[model samples]
Target: MLDEAEDDRDAAAPIDMLERYFAAHGWSHQRDEDEIVAKVKGSWTEFELRAIWRADDGVLQFLAFPDVRVADDRRGAIYEAIGLINEQLWIGHFELWSSSGILLFRHAAMIDVEEAALSLEQAEVLVDTAIDECERFYPVFQFVLWGGKSPREAIAASMIETRGEA
Candidate 1:
């Protein structure tokens, strides 16, 4: 019984570390049960982050949803474009919540109490990766939804390399 209780605390230690990290970073966040909801300001769009500690799986997962929501008519194109973009990504991937037509970036990292002390830093890396991937591909989403561009065209337009610094 005592061992079981200790295991429960160990499982929750990562979440506790994440919550403290959010507070220390001055991010306005609310904790609800086992999840933390916060807002992240990105270069291309404002993103809402939902982080949940799934004790059953012993992993911390994060979902970053941008301000833009896809329309029903554009879902297919957006989905195709996400597939292309996700291929280029090293970690995390874009996904559309079909029922709601909400697109988001998702990623997860495994955790244990031994690494709980570094949870705060690891969480930051996960958050940064999610935000960077979303911001990088945000233009493709806009092109497909508003510009009426094909998936390939949108990806090409967004991938154009800059020649020189500003």
Candidate 2:
């Protein structure tokens, strides 16, 4: 029984598992041998999330591009707000692609075990957390990008909590 189970585990690929997980959640996704791409809609924005599985490193990375490129003039403010926003994230953080001025969120996990050993729930969390973090901080980026707000002000604006309906 042990040998059979191990064989089964070995037969399942991580990419396949992730593809199935994305399907199970009713998400539209595309996958090749190395990566899977999905579009996730957050409260503030719609973003494309890419999950790349590195066989050699046993690491899988989920990245979400918020579709907002920080303009050259505003990169400074956005960069500062990203620093503040990153401090609040528990699982993933934001990053700026310097060359392209693109802002994205990234979350990664190391699954040293066989691909079959990872459950759909585990994969879901990775995507969910990445999307959630992006949703949470997108407003901060917008505040800095569009509102001409200072980094501290943007962070503060994004952090406001509402208690009840007015």
Candidate 3:
């Protein structure tokens, strides 16, 4: 059994590890209380990666926001695309903030007390997964929003696997 001081230290360990991870990668980040926000440039676009550590619940919620906005008229199509995209994802899910019409990817992991700390590799994987998924599916959203393609069509186009470069 650990005392309050030890418990508190354990709770903050993940965030501190994340801070170090971000700094090592040369990603610009800001830490506020239990949250850290970092700016990362993905292949498709820029992304804002945010992580919030919940001390009481020992949960770490990670989010990646792609710099894309959906128009009011395209919400229905975007929502459909999100469903299709999320279906194929194993770790996280994509969500559109209805009020702001912004698209973001979100995932959460539980850090057990026994574990007590988040490893740097785990932090790297979390961030990489978010950005990779965002980059992979960004054009699908673009196809639906600006190219006037159906959700299925957009997904199909995005799924085309390219071979070795010419």
For model 1, what is the C-alpha lDDT against the true structure? 0.79
Clashes of each: 0, 0, 0
Candidates sorted by TM-score, descending order?
3, 2, 1
Give the poorly placed runs of model 1, Cα more than 4 Å off. 1-12, 113-118
Write one digit per residue (lDDT tens) for candidate 2, span 1-166. Answer: 1223444334346677677766766778999998889876667877898988888888888788988997788888888888888887788889899999999998888877454345555766887788777877788888888888898998888889999998
lDDT of each: 0.79, 0.78, 0.87
Shift in Å, residue 56, candidate 2: 0.8
The positional error of residue 28 in candidate 3, measured at the CA in angstroms, is 0.8
1-166 in candidate 1: lDDT tens per residue?
A: 1222433333336556556656656777888767888887888888898888877776788899998788888898998998998889888888999889999999988776354433344756877788788888899999999998999999999999899889
The predictions' CA RMSDs to the true structure, in order, are 6.8, 5.2, 6.1
Q: What is the lDDT of candidate 2?
A: 0.78
Best by TM-score: 3
Q: What is the TM-score of each candidate against the true structure?
A: 0.85, 0.86, 0.90
Give candidate 3's error at residue 165 in angstroms: 3.0
Question: TM-score for model 2?
Answer: 0.86
